[model samples]
Target chain A: MSNSTSNTPEKDHKSSYRAEERRTLSSGEEEFFFDVKTSDMEVNMGPQHPATHGVMRVLIRCDGELVTGSQVHLGYLHRCAEKIGENVEWLQYLPYTDRYDYLAAMNNNLGYSMAVEALMPGLEIPRRAVLLRTINVELNRIASHLVAYGTYGLDIGAITPFLYAFREREWIQALFEKICGARLTYSYIRIGGVFNDAPPGWLKEVGHFCDVFEEKWKEYRDLLALNHIFIKRTAHVGVIPKDMAIDFGLTGPMLRGSGVDFDLRRDMPYMAYGEAYEAGAFKVPVGSGEKGELGDSWDRFYVRVEEMMESIKLVRWCLGVIEDGPIIGEIPKVIKVPAGEAYVGIENPRGELGHYVHSDGGKVAVRCRVRGPSFTNIAVVEELMPGTLLADSVAIIGSTDIVIGETDR
Target chain B: MELQAIHDTLKAAGVVGLLGCDEPRPANKKEKDPGRAGMPFLLVDPAEIVPLLTACRDESRLQFDLLIDLTASDPAADGDDLWVLIQLLSLKYRHRLAIKAHLPKSALSIASATAVYRAANWHERECSEMFGITFEGHPDPRKILLPDDWKGFPLRKDYEFPTEYHGISCE
Candidate 1:
């Protein structure tokens, strides 16, 4: 596996000495040279770099330190999950969903399970299954937001918050492992219900974590949000307006940060969000201060923090409501949906993660199209990146919370 | 609000007859008629697309601002014409309209909507590269998601996936 290299001539002593002489040109002559050949300079950000958060290559066209334009190259982590969904059975593809957005595996599981349930309506899942799904998804949401906040901080040169955020996330992953036997890609969620009920003492452990998390939340806010330097780096930067956000088809925190007041879990209320809980039971606090200024990077960061707090509230609510019942519904071993097409969307940690399933009453889905939130959210970069500094682009992209797996899937 | 009212509005704007919208079914299914579901999508003639989309946006009951998704599907094997489906969502009306236009397998040309919606630039480019369709007035119509020197559209039914591109295997 030898790496490929370009065969361009290296800059030896003669070329360097000649290049140095050109730098000392007169001002008038330099202006003439600049006017005559104003070719765009190409700079490759990475196929292997740290700030990208994953294997993504962006070719940035720049005029000095200002980014003129950028072309994002994907397929670095393309596993063809959609094509794989076609090949596998309907029930077996739940595991592959975890790999799409591994940061929020439970949300991925919930989205796929909801799509299947919508296709095969009247599966008769017990109340316990719904509560367990809500708890697992909210826990996943907290873990995902922790990574987004931690990595965003890391991008802006903060190290302590990233370590603290991961320290808390490890505990949540351990809770998931105890229930499903696998940590990250736990395909615990089934078509009509979940794979198994929560183990003994699982609810008690989750309850204790929620109490501990409330204290840790204050510490996080004090450590990072209250810091003057972090605020200066984030506030009023990468401000996404509400109208432009709607125009670009943005959703989730990206939309809520813009003061849209639209959440699928609240607005559409799939799963146990509406039926099993009260209206104000799980309150995810959206940031509110001013009108046009709501969607700035600071608000975007604060929205995630408040969302973590809300998820904790929902987890506690689920732990209280969870009871002993049949976990798996009366679904046949070989599942077959009706011959029709349905588009099912769930409020994933990222945004509106939708699965459009078309079945022919066959063994496998005829076509399964995923409307990835990252793909739509990242498209607004062309609208946002025109007049920003080169360095601020990284901060803006990080704040959007895009995973390349979902973007390129 | 209804498909007929929107169709009448487009007709008043000098569009041709609105082709019947066909709800696609499985290959082996016996049903061939397009009925009125809870939400109905109207298919318009390809030549009248630019005017119809413009009228649909300007009309009071139908202000389809958001182009939800656009893609081309191969229907030649199913004894049907090749069609491009443009799904539009109206935020004001809270409705979805799927406009369909059929062309011969060889010639798949439609008017570009980049002038109407800025977001259609990349979506049209992606469709063009995947289905070998041509958007007549597309600005900077270049290949996206695929290389410039790539041979054929991979998503087309008869198209074959290449083993390598510029010495890098696509696999």
Candidate 2:
């Protein structure tokens, strides 16, 4: 090009560009190219995002990759279940309870039924019905924890565990379907007792499922619970102290995961759990920080995984103590609950699900208040999200295992 | 501890505004009315809620460290007062207590329990929005389960269901 006379214009342009660059560098103006001015950017996750297991929105403010602040906006799935409870009769509210925590409908059913039954002083739940209720509730707890385990793995970018977890969960759902007509929202546990007795061979099938699940449980532990990359991403990520756990009103696995050996089923037993606890059928598994700090994300996830096995033990115990008898109490078709108010709290898979029913000697309840565990458990995310990375925020939210339907209801 | 013992302990602590205990009574043959057969609850003055809860939590014999649930209920469509219910649990002693504060509907406001337990923050917000009760010193008193510009308190007995919201039918 230098030898070619026709390329003079090209040579002039190249020389001028090089001279400009040299002059700018000599003048100390190159910092403008390397320096970046930043402000906190607000990012909205969910009401539709996948990380949020349901329709919940989290507004997060980030400085680069660090989360500086967060605000959780709920009510997206509010159906006013409390109001419906006030309007419906005593027995009609059971189906409404199933919608709050759809994944653990049996637990919700048990909670509401127990609360209403508390008012009927003369009502008696048959022995066989109590055993059946225990079996169904414990099995549902396993199914609920399986979802928590699977989705938490999915949140941490492990896909195989979710498939394995759901495969087992589906088997549980099928057992429920065989007993009741509906699979997802069975509403099987009624006010006095259960809707019906288990179908023939169903209990034996449950025993078989327990045997198979014990083998698959080991595979699940190896696949995701002990994976190196999963541990690195989750362990020590969102550590909540024991004081904070109690201060926030957290219960169930959330409280136990903080190394607080308080299980409502054992401490305040209900629905034959007291008998089961006395029988030494199962043990409460508290987080010991096996891989990281106690109350961290992995600790909470591990607690749920361990709880599934504990629930299996509980189901097996129920099967061992089964007897043939009536499956329901003698509840009137048109129920008229005595004039009184009772608050019955049962140990749901997530936490203490309390039902406060106030009656004025009428067919309908004057006030029906539900103390949803997911509602209280999810509130701590606001305190946990700040000072975490954007990716770890997902881990913390997933660890809470909140169903938005329960949160909003 | 039994309900009587807990109440005696609270009374001994010089806790002001103790309105005595409401015991359970079964339905009688003569009255034919199913009497209050539910769990006994302590009735306290709304103004002294903070002190009452503080005493319940701090007393050596009665260490109610966990605030299990906080909610409010309206008795009737035309009731004169709303009852604010607070359930407390002690992890150390494994005893539970239920305290109800009678807030007159004419003045539906009370001291927020958030000072005693941080868990009360969200519970107070929910009570405030649903029952139209004003928690005097709550940090964040925003509407929790309802929209920002909701028309009326939905949980109140006298609340009227709205026909539409934002061009969408609610009925």
Candidate 3:
């Protein structure tokens, strides 16, 4: 199909397509000439495109069939979350965090609450609350990763894997609903601890979920992870170097996929993670390129798969150690954080979610800033996008697993 | 490196304009938060920011390689002029340090950190558009989270909510 038979399909498709496009565009009897500016194009990939997964537009420039460069345009969903945080009471701000990373709302809640807690007097979390939080947040992480995995499958040509992943996610949502009232935006993780303690038999149900999920995880892997086409689309595409990943401030799986052994849960060891990590049973799996180039789209995709398994392991551990006690901490009804600033970062499913709170000894904060992980992580797409074919760019974006809620917020 | 050691090194290196640790801690919650606990920040002269941050990144022991965040706060209770907090993290030693610099309302500008950390590009852009502080040498300093012709910096405590944006009633 190439203009010359001397070229391979991979290298020649673009030339052939461009030639065909030119022939069609200038085919009239009237005189016509090929123009490079008209031939070479810039494509806007959406504030509404399904592939974008949320309200975001990617401005991509293409030479023939290959993308030459790109830029990310966000803020379509900017609700001024920070400005609202400054106006609302401390407790009223919890629900707004829910909408930031809606897929990982619990983690967002936990991160924001912890930042506020840093400003409180005598704010040490209880052991029982820690264990409960470890369970709930890790469960939320599993649910978040399920969305990422399922949608990545959707981004690729697979339909059934989305069903499989969502079926499991539904189970987790039901469990979360039993403990907290809502499913999607469950503002369960309050400032001091969880909104409430787990109901009786909830931990046993988690154990059951983990046991059944392990076998299903293998089947899900067999369906897509080992599929040759999935491998072809992702492997060796969007390769990122470790130093570049660090310089761009990618955290969580995005950083780990590039072979960085840094996870705030393990490194900083907040909540119940310190003891679990100290026991030496916790595992941090970096990209070994088991099936693709290091830090490629496949490596990023695989890291999420492996992290889901780790979340299950964490849930099991928390269930084993959880003790009976008060879930809520003794925070004052009319909360007045001291006049100062506090910043705290927690490992969300997407990456490092940090909350910065500046209070002027008032009922509401002076400024509540969020360093959304997806906001920073999404910036690396431009570095990975150029020189890749248009199709592969979709794979890279999907592999990064960003919720545009976090990106645009 | 311990914070005290990093503080001593900054002092010994003869970087001027750093306020001492006796600036009456921010509202007595210092005993709980570690980063700002006894957080003695260097009030770097605006002209010397690039060199100070570059040293923090390249220094052998206190390699503050990660630019955690670059944010501007109105700090309304303290001053009319806004303050910018440049947070740096050292991956080598697992320590974090803060650099505080203030910008007056008349000329709200400071040297950009993009030359030192590429991650600063977007954060700096966001900070500039939201708080109206100019990142002097940022490669592409455009309004990131707002419309290009947006009238005011929304994050400043005194910023009034617009009654309308481009003829659409916002009130």
Candidate 4:
């Protein structure tokens, strides 16, 4: 790596001309021309680049083709959601949750709703609303994981699967559009209940989707999971051990991939989760290989695939047993709760989306903080990246399934 | 474990003397015991947090391996004490202990839990940056979410949002 070899004549001419100009200016003084050495190479992966998936700037320090080190610069998309949450009313803030993790808006909605609902004891949300919420949220989870698995393949060399994943995702989005007015940011969930009841034949459409998803899921696995190139790209890369995963406070599939058998829905059931119908239907099955090694990119990928299958099963179950009833719970027009603090954690698509809310016996919450799983997942990148190659870093990041919106929120 | 037994154990350990254990809130909410029998809550000084956590971790009955969540709240409207809440969960006992340390907002200094739990590194960093609380022993204490040159702690009640920093106007 020689700095003196000027590759382009234009750059060399400009450099020499600047040097000559400086020399002419310092003719009357004794000046020392200290040499300034640049690095071996530097690349800006972007605040605008496509592979970054969001407005993230990663400055990569490379020696030849290998990455020496890297620094992640976030906040390009920061909206100060916590501050915004404080300014808005409890119900008004429900719409903003959708923007936090736009990929899985329903999970975000459910997390905030559950936290608020926890404060108000004896608020009975109808069975239909709970079932509707479960179905839509599972659909959103499938859509989110599809984007994760598909874009992950796109992050690597495989481009065809990205379209395939998007095609399936569009179907789910269509169902969401039918239920809610919006597609991506469906703020369908209310504080006590949902915005509205499910439309006519909505359950049938979801049931039809569940019927078709099993076959489509196999196609997804065949396109990427069985592909030798993708396996070579991801396997044994970005392995976060069980202890390290726990120490880093990693959750969701990332923690489960490291063999931690903790799922919030299964471990600590909340909001009609442990009911007899939901117990048999909506359980998330953990993925396992022959040797039972959990901490690998393959395990993470397979877990998301298995989770999608489980989510489909859950949606089918919810549609069959759902009964028509009042969506909103009985409460005063102006909602007020006793002064107390409650922390609620829901299993979002990426990980545990925890909300810690403190109320001062008023309509407004005193303090609310979201414990985003993406934040913890992204923190372990420094631990995972040291020994891996430059290209593999993208795979590791994608496999980690980080949404910078959620992380930087 | 019964609440009285838990209180008795803490009293036996000599932790009750430092913080006055006079009036305990009864486990039964209806019982009006103004000056109760035992300490319902233990108030450990900010400096003694690490040692107390270590003791709790090492104790046979209280093997608190998980530092569940750490948060800072402004309890007083007059901007008095910054209440730091630390929730520790023991996997062995399946019990949770909530420890709160009240410090003046001006001097928001507390010992870091990095040595006890590695997960506390980021949690403490977030708390420190957001609430203007300084975790004394944290290795990398620089701003986590906010920019290095950020003017004020945004989460604090008294924080004023700046229009600009480093000649970049936020407006």
Q: Which candidate number would show the highest lDDT if scored against the true structure? A: 2
The TM-scores of all predictions, comma-separated, are 0.82, 0.93, 0.90, 0.83
Give a tens-digit lDDT track for model 1, residues B53-155: 7776677767876665566655334434566666665656555576768867756788887776655667688779867889999976886556577798655
Which segments of candidate 1 are over 4 A away from where they belong? A1-40, A276-278, A287-292, B1-68, B72-104, B157-159, B163-171
Q: Rate the local accuracy (lDDT) of all candidates.
A: 0.72, 0.87, 0.79, 0.72
Better of 1 and 3 by DockQ: 3
Q: Rank the candidates by DockQ, best first.
A: 2, 3, 1, 4
Q: Report the error of model 4 at residue A197, Å.
A: 0.4
RMSD of each: 8.9, 10.7, 6.0, 10.5
lDDT of 4 at B117: 73
TM-score of chain A of each: 0.88, 0.91, 0.90, 0.86
Per-residue lDDT tens digits for candidate 3, residues A9-104, read 222112123433333211133213324444568999998877789989999898766676788888888889988988899989999999999999
Question: Per-residue CA lDDT of candidate 4, range B67-87, in tens?
Answer: 656767765457678877765
Candidate 1: tens digits of C-alpha lDDT, residues A41-121: 788877776777788777777655545577777667767576577668898888889888888888888888887776665
What clash pairs does model 1 have? none
Q: What is the lDDT, from 0 to 100, of the residue A164 in candidate 4?
A: 93
lDDT of 2 at B159: 95
TM-score of 3: 0.90
Model 2 bad stretches (over 4 Å): A1-37, B169-171
What is candidate 4's TM-score for chain B alone?
A: 0.77
